[model samples]
Target: MQMMSVSALNEKIKSLLEATFLHIRVEGEVASVTYHSSGHLYFSVKDDRSTLRCVMWRSNVSRMRFRLEKGEHIVIDGSIGVYTPRGEYQLIAVQIEPYGRGALALAFEQLKKKLEAKGYFDATRKKPLPPYPRRIALVTAAGGAALQDMLKVARRRWPLVELLVLDVRVQGEGAAEEIARGIAYADTLGADLIVTGRGGGSVEDLWAFNEEAVADAIYAAQTPVVSAVGHEVDTLISDFVADLRAPTPSAAIEMILPDANELLRTIDELGEQMGRRVAQILHQKEERLRREAEAIRGASVLRRLVTLEESFARIGRDLREVIRYRLSQFEGRISPLERQMTESVDLRLRRSGEELRSLSEALRRNDPTLRSKEGWAEVLSEGRRRALESIKVGERFELSDGRVKVRAQCLEKRPLK
Candidate 1:
């Protein structure tokens, strides 16, 4: 083996790598990425157990369709080269792609995940579309099919609604800025509703609506926004952030505008219903009035009422005549009976008075008081008597008259012989 300087050895290794592994293709995940101020990208590509250094020059990076992010699985198309200064080999990638549906899908998924983590895709953040829009703003590319379709549908649906057009770049470079500015400006214009979209195209052609700036502008708007980007299948970030999503630009117009013809038909139908109701009510009232008139015209009801009134008058006259006759008969009979009773009572009182006087005089003539002067009565002893055996000869005894009293004394005793 011949010994040589490190630079010589590096040069030999560089030649070997270029000659042997030129135009190589490798598949792995991005490990670390550094975008330099010099407009160069330095990164490492890795598998489970090994890593390879890689560099993409600014010139090539400018041509790339997508930016590299850490942990993204990708396939690199380039050649192997050795750096003599570092004595290490690295991949000089000309083109890089996502492992699957390529960088477009990767970029979309990345943005979606980022916005979702920030709660930008939450359903609660969405607002309700206005039921009626007096004025509508259309933010779309100039002369596109989407703008024309919207205009046509709006005119047919509700011609009264004023259409305000703010044409902008729908896709390509600077399209996102233009679309964002249009949304903000339209929000300031006091339009009742806003509809912004473009016709269907490839993901690259529709990428402007998916940009973060457009989504943020739509979210910040005070007026409601309806996003109709591409076909029904094409969903973008703006669609999620806007107040409403329509499958097509024409569909958005349909949502915001009411059909004038249909409204007129409804109004006419209502007027007819009202007329029928009013007619029915008048018919019912007229039928009721006719029934009442027929009842009043009938003669039987009037005849019954007259008969009852005559009966009540006849009863009143008969009651007055009966009371007057009974009073006259009581007056004639009571006058004679009262005079006879007074004469009989006077005769009976005179006879009873004479009989009482005669009886009383007879009784007085037979009374004992007439002879009291001749029939004087005396009592010898009124209260007590004393026997001779108990009295001395000189003892006095009293003889009492009813009017006067005399006292006497016994002086001698006499024998019976």
Candidate 2:
């Protein structure tokens, strides 16, 4: 075994580590922190299972955007180094950033905040979605769930709308460039709307949407663009830059396309309401017309006399002929009825006179006064003969007819018994 002093060995290790890891990147959370009077930062970085010590000199610390604290997740760009005195390996951090997110994430957030300050996300600036989009451009991968889901939704909701799809890679290198070009191309085609999105994935997988190139592309697009990346929980730069942000790819279609059946039903209901309104108006007009007619009829009595007087002066010859014709027809109808009534009255008077004469003859034949007028002398003789038989020789009696009475004495008495 080759024997060497500990100082010599430590120096050899330091030279080898510095050369081998001259530049590198590390991601972890800060477990502990220390700030020195000389403006140096010292902290331990750890993951779920292991830890590493990191240091930033005052020269590099001035370049950092954030201060290091215990339990803060961060990424360190540095070289691996060995401390000869302690014989330990450590990271000499050139740059330090919040770890869970990469430099791209930080950039994304910075741009978002900047755009927010500029009012890019203001509701007023957003273009209204076309109520009936006739042409649509889809910027997404050729064979992906996002494209398929959106297609299904578009077809189901509104099949008449034309969908123009531009295939583009959504992940890996050169993806952001392709996406930006696709957006520009789709817009140049005069599409009514543009939709760009992908299915859910890791943050790295969705990094293309976070790129500034994509955000600028969306902002520059003349046509309205809908951003739908990953699932509901995922958010990216394109979401803010675009005119609208949908929770998912399919939801973008749902927002832009209206259901045809629902529109038809609404049209039918409006038609029925219009018909009812027209009918009601017509009925009201009819009632008003009837009232006007009645008013005209009531005025006819006074108006007709004045009208006849005026018209008689203007066309009296013509109207007089028509009136004469009507009066002659009325006379023809009344003549027979008048003659019949006159004849009936005369015959009734004649029959009444005959009945009066017969009744008078019957009353006289039974009258006692009529009998007194007949056989006056014969009655007086009969009564005198009866009295003489009953009279004694010296008796006196009164004998008379109805008109004359005489007083006499019995001169002889004859008893024939």
Candidate 3:
């Protein structure tokens, strides 16, 4: 053979293979299908004798209707190509179809059915997620993007959540064993919930989710497990066995974290409501006090007492005035009576003095001395007459010194003669 350049030979081989297998269909069973983080599907197609490597770009994978799994018998339409760098022939699957059940499918179904019969999927066996988890254990790769995403989401949602991260292999050899150990350790550490998952990947990349040990560990966990594996369309045995399933690692975080803003808003609203209720109660009490004050004002004991006192004082004044008036009238009547009595006494005294003076005058007028003087005068006249007559008759007279003496009886008889 003529010597050919490596690049030239590679080009010729690539052209020839592309032209020959441009529109060929191959039927086989799927094995080790892995969807990479780069959005490429890589797997092997195998039969009884041989196996071939295959790749399906994400653009074509989106068009596929069925979910692909390991050991699933399928028919594929693609062209063969030679990898110049590695010197390997491979198929670029353009279309895929499910033909029958694969070996891995039979085993998955058998295990699922056995567990279901044993009541593993029973509602009674399933555990509920805690309302407010105190601590959460994350079983995943230590520096994986899924861990960072979960931490970011959890911190933003609920910063107070205690995170216990178990650094372990999420995929490849011994991944399932490490994942099972992580779950057991989380339980021993008394975690509230276990968040285990990885970023989106192919079936082979997420094969740890299919491990019986991982599924059994999740199922046996006392703490609730939340499985977040692969894309939304991907389902794993761990998802069925776990207490809860999330579509992505971020979704698992959201499921476990509480919204801080919503809780704060609720607390604020409760405070406002309590304040309003208290204010209303105070307002009612104030109104009641006002009504009581009005009642007291209307029938005040002090006011009544003052009114009674005033009435009593007025009555006392009136009584005093009446007594004074009566006394004045009595004084007026008594004073005149006293004056009249004094005048009457004076008049009677004057009358008695007048009567006494008249009696004294009569006694004085009829005194004996005056009567004797008058009688002597009369008798003297008679005697003088008689003497004159007797002297003429008897012519007898006795004279002694300058006095005359006359006889009484005999001289009277002579006078009469």
TM-score of each: 0.64, 0.54, 0.48
C-alpha lDDT of residue 19 in model 1: 93
Per-residue lDDT of candidate 3, residues 180-294 (tens digit): 9999989899888998989988777897787778988888889999999877898888888888889999999888778888889999999999999999999999999999999
In terms of lDDT, model 3 sits at 0.82
Poorest stretch of ten by lDDT in candidate 3: 376-385
lDDT of 2 by residue, 181-253 (tens): 9999999998899999999999889988987789888888889999989999999988988899998999889
Ranking by lDDT, best first? 1, 2, 3
Q: How accurate locally is residue 40 in candidate 2, as Cα lDDT from 0 to 100? A: 94
Instruction: Give the 10-residue window scoring lowest on summed lDDT in candidate 2.
Output: 375-384
lDDT of 1 by residue, 1-417 (tens): 899999988898899889988888999999999999999989999999999999989988876657798998999998998878888889998889999767777777778888889887788877777777799889998789999999888889888999899999998988999999999999999998888999999999999998888988998889989999999999998888888999888888887789999989999999999999999999999999999999888658878999999999999999999999999999999989999999888888888888889888887655445433566433244457545444457767664434556687768766556
Q: Candidate 3: give the clashing pairs.
A: 35-202
- How many clashes in each structure? 0, 1, 1
Error of 3 at 386 (Å): 99
The superposed Cα distance between candidate 2 and the true structure at residue 238, in angstroms, equals 1.3
| CA lDDT of each prediction against the hidden true structure | 0.86, 0.85, 0.82
Q: Which stretches of model 1 miss by more than 4 angstroms? A: 1-3, 15-22, 34-40, 58-69, 284-417
